[model samples]
Target: MFKGKFRIVAVICFVLFGVMAYLSSQMSFGPRDKILPGIYVLNVKLSRMDRDQAIQAMKKMEASFKQARTIQYRELSWSLPMDQVGLRLNYEEEVERAMSFGRTGSLWQQFLERREAHRSVHLKPEIHLDANLLEKTVTAAAETIILPPRDAGLIINDNDTVEISPGREGRLVDINHLQQELIKSLLTDSRSPIPLKLVVAPPVRSTEEVSAMGINRLLAMYSTQFDPNKVNRAYNVSVAAAALDGLTVAPREVMSFNEVVGPRSTEAGYKTAPIIVNNELVDGLGGGVCQVSTTLYNAVLLANLEVVERTNHSMPITYVPIGRDATVVFDAIDFKFRNNTDYWLYIQSHVKGGTLVIKIFGNEQFKKDVVIRSWIEETYNPDTLVENDYSIRMGDRLIKQKGAQGYRVSAERVVMEKGQVVKVEKLPTSVYKARNQIISQGMAPPGDILSNPELPADDSPVNGEMEEAEER
Candidate 1:
């Protein structure tokens, strides 16, 4: 009888424990759309909330974190929005994560999760930060705060005096450290304003360090003029010229136009302008850049440097004299010259008013007077071609198309020392193809000749300029 009584009490205890376990899981399984009770992320309670409600709850925390988040350096401060630096919390993932707690696992594990939820489960949201975006933001801020160092320069006085300009030190931000600090400030609830870690950046070299590394005197200078009214083309010309400023080449080194200027696209800050293609000028990117190269080529020739490679346009360009202009295309065609002298060759270029000028400098010992001479070796006028038109009279003519004159031009570099031509080097011969003039003759009568040999060949009039020329 005592044994029977013990068995009954054991059965009652088992039923009580089963009821308690079910009660725990029942708390977790209260509603399909709701999160279990007692869940929080960063002190923001998320219990009994749906996915949307939980996301809305997390945004409150985001707003508090983003309030007045500023990074200050000196007198400048950048108010960083979450999107600027690509710092954001994946609210959808966080809500899903919060909802997954008691709803996951088997019944036993669910009960355990529910029990743990009563004790309060706290978590941090998944942070998404793009390193590149962060760096760009910091760099933009640094650009505003930092003062760039100036390098020493030279000025040629009117009385033939060489003046050396002074150089100055600059201050720059500690980028890596600043990035770390930014990340730390973002991850924690630090209310202090972010401070920049700036470093003193000295000049690349002292002005007095080496005044003459074979660059004591100006070797040659060439200038080309452009119409400032052509806004896009002028901008491209200026950009290309600026790229060549302060360019230095050691002895035996070669300078390439395409390499220095790089790719000319909208991304590289070039606008569409007139470009020559198949001897016809059309709207294209980096149109006026060739003018920069042409000017540089003339300067290089006047400097008596060795020309490694150069190519002239299919047709004669109006900016430079025939056989003097150099045409360059990225990757496919390039303008290159070698620094044949023992001293360093330095190139300086700038655009002023409406002119682009390029100057070459090197040792005074290598300086020689160079005069460029060019002439037309052969001229080929466009031949007139007539097409009989039955709709018009025999002697009457209608101009269908205009034509261009072709030429074979030659250029020579006359190097002079002490007023005597020491060397005369001929440049590559340039040839332009003649475009045939088309004319329509009236052949209204059956009596009109099928092939008019005695066709009158006088042009009507030279009216407006070609549309292509105006673009240039």
Candidate 2:
């Protein structure tokens, strides 16, 4: 009977302990209600607090920490604001951790903790940072500290001498390393401004390298004049000349006119001007660029450079004689030459006072005296063809166009050494076809008394005047 009584008392005690533990979890606490002793969050006491009270206490502590933190760079310092860099805390996870101080574990274990309040629990809030905000901050700081390297340059003097300029080094932030430092700052609450790492950037080339190219001494030069009155044509001529300036060609390199000059279009700054099309004068784009090519062609010939490729215009141009003109049509036609010397060659071109000049420079051994010569080998006069138009008045004569004689012309390149002709190289011949004169004569009135029935003789006044300079 005594043993039975002890069992009943033990059952009652177990039931009472279960009810108290359930009530602890359900019941709310007042502002003054104390949490179990020995509970701390990041060294701040969170004991003797309810759920809401514990959260508020942590918020106040966080504010104070952020207010005192600063990131310093030299004399400049930036405040560590929770809002600016999107600093965030896992509030739910941290609060749950704090609340679990004595609430967790087996029934007996929990009861034991509450019985004496002897256990100590310490925890830190889980922190996070917005990725985009961190990236932006680091990138902005990088821009301020980064410097780009400057490449070496060339300066052409008034006397056609070239000078070299030194290049400069630059410093740039190492992004990967900077990002790593930023992560540490966010995770560890590090307030010190992180020192940035940099890499040394060297220029593409140095002054000493450019100076060793050996682009000196005038090998050959040529200049041609144009009418500045033609505004668009003159502008195109200037544009083409400017493109060829300061061009450097290595030894045995072939320089192409089309490649260097590029396309001749309105987008490329060429304007409409008179150009030869199908052996007839017509307004077209890049009209005056040919003059630039022709001028350069003569200069290259005078330099005794190897002519890799060249072609003349269909007919003679007024600026250069028949076989001397070099006509280019972008990708279709081109003028090219090779730098056959052992050293580098430089081409300098400019437009001044209505003249376009092209100068080729190389080593002294490449210099030569070159003379150009042209002569007509064969000539012929074409028969003048006449046309009749009813619009002309009766007995009134009109000459629509004057005729031009056809000729086959030959050009020679004369190379001289010490006042004696070393070689006479015959160039390609140019053939020009004659354009006939067109005459229009009006018809007489039908059966009129003023109209003479007999036609005029071959030596009549109208026919005799045309034969004054007859060759045959």
Candidate 3:
């Protein structure tokens, strides 16, 4: 009876333990998992609970997530515009209240506590732009503008009565004034993209106008003196035209003859060979161009212009006097003169009937009475000759003689005022080499010398008489 009673109690205890295990397996805590009541033990499996709890938990989590997101935005609120300042502050306040409730462990926290909470969230950034404000700021900065004064009068005037007036004078526009105008225009309306127009006034004519004129006046002054056709005919097309063309001379400036002429090549139609460096004679592009420089040198001197630089030729030239010639070789050589007068000078070039002339016209105040003269310092006559004879024993027989030595000459320039010497300048010296004199061997002897001993003896007496007369 005791054994049967113990077996019945054990089976009852086993059934109770099985029922508790099945109940525990059917229980659900969140929306993703749920427990069903009275389900068979072997059939019990996990199931979706009323998502309202899970969803409610999620909703609480979402609210908590939004509060956390608001806190993050508040931290970054300083970067927002003025208009969003109040909005950002209000959102920060709501987040602070939510965090307070979360700390208290209220119903909202309980729902959130049922599941894992979201740790991160993303928020959109805002940008603000005001086109009108930008435009107003730009326009205010650009309100005031300054412009350069415009050029007003005639540049070249040909109509005249008494003296031959070349065309109107050329003028230089003030570069500073132009630059200021450009700056003002740029600052006024940066977006307008309109370029400021520069108005350069034509030259004015006053008593001072005569000096302001350039080479044009010089050319016109002497135009009537020469026949242009004849002057042109003398120059190679390239050199001649450049010579006749008016030159530009700035105030108190020096002009270079070769620099203005540039290079004379076949391309430039300069058929003659140019005088090269060190006054060495070489066949080059510009040959006869030196004539132009030489002519200008004379003109500058005649005008009483100050000579800044001038060099003589390696050899004497036929066109100008020995001391008056100016040689130029591009940058290496130059005939330069300064415009000492206060007024501008005009250079006019032209050819007239086999002559090349350059004229300089400026104020008379700067003009001076200038004169240049030169003479040979000394003359040397080295009439000595040396002879050499080689005999048949030393290969071929021959005779040789060296020629006479040449002379060295120096010259000077003198400036005069009111018949009084003001300044004197020493010119360069030149030395010529002697030529070699050679006499061939086996030449015919003089028959007169062999035929007359008395004539030879008489020749010495005659030479002696000539020498005595010279001494007396």
Ranking by TM-score: 1, 2, 3
Please provide, for model 3 over 1-472, each residue's C-alpha lDDT reduced to its tens digit, 9 standing for 90 to 100. 9999999999988877764453333231221233122211112111232323323433343332222111111112111121211212233332332233212365444334322212212121121223344223322332233222332222333431113243343332233443333233322322223222223444444434442442223212322122234322244523643654656566789877666677655665666432433322344455556666766777776666678887766544445555566666666777788977666676656664655556666555555556656555555453533333221122222334334334455655666667888777665565533333444233233342123222211111122121111000
Better of 1 and 3 by lDDT: 1
Better of 2 and 3 by TM-score: 2
> lDDT by residue for model 2 over 1-472, one digit each (tens)?
9999999999999888775654365332212344566677766687777777777887776564444344444565554344554555665567677666556687656666554444555566665556567546554544555677877766667887766677888775555665566556644656677766677878887666666777657889899888787788889889999999989999999999999989989899888876766544557888788889889989998998888887777555666665777778887888999999888888889999788899998887767799988888888676766666445456665665555566788888999888998888877676766655556565544344244334331211132222111100
Where does candidate 2 stray beyond 4 Å? 1-150, 168-194, 394-397, 418-420, 443-472
lDDT of each: 0.78, 0.70, 0.43
TM-score, model 2 to reference: 0.61
Instruction: Return the TM-score for each candidate structure.
Output: 0.64, 0.61, 0.41
**Model 2, poorest ten-residue lDDT window?**
463-472
Q: Distance (Å) between predicted and true CA of 199, model 1? A: 4.5
Say which prediction, candidate 1 or candidate 2, comes out ahead on TM-score: 1
Best-fitting candidate, scored by lDDT: 1
lDDT (tens digit, per residue) of candidate 1 on 161-218: 4456767788777766766776577567776678888888777765764365547788
Assess the local accuracy of residue 179 in candidate 3 as a C-alpha lDDT between 0 and 100.
Answer: 36
Where does candidate 1 stray beyond 4 Å?
Answer: 1-24, 28-33, 69-87, 102-116, 126-216, 224-292, 313-321, 327-334, 338-356, 362-366, 375-384, 389-392, 397-407, 414-424, 434-440, 445-472
Indicate the TM-score of model 1.
0.64
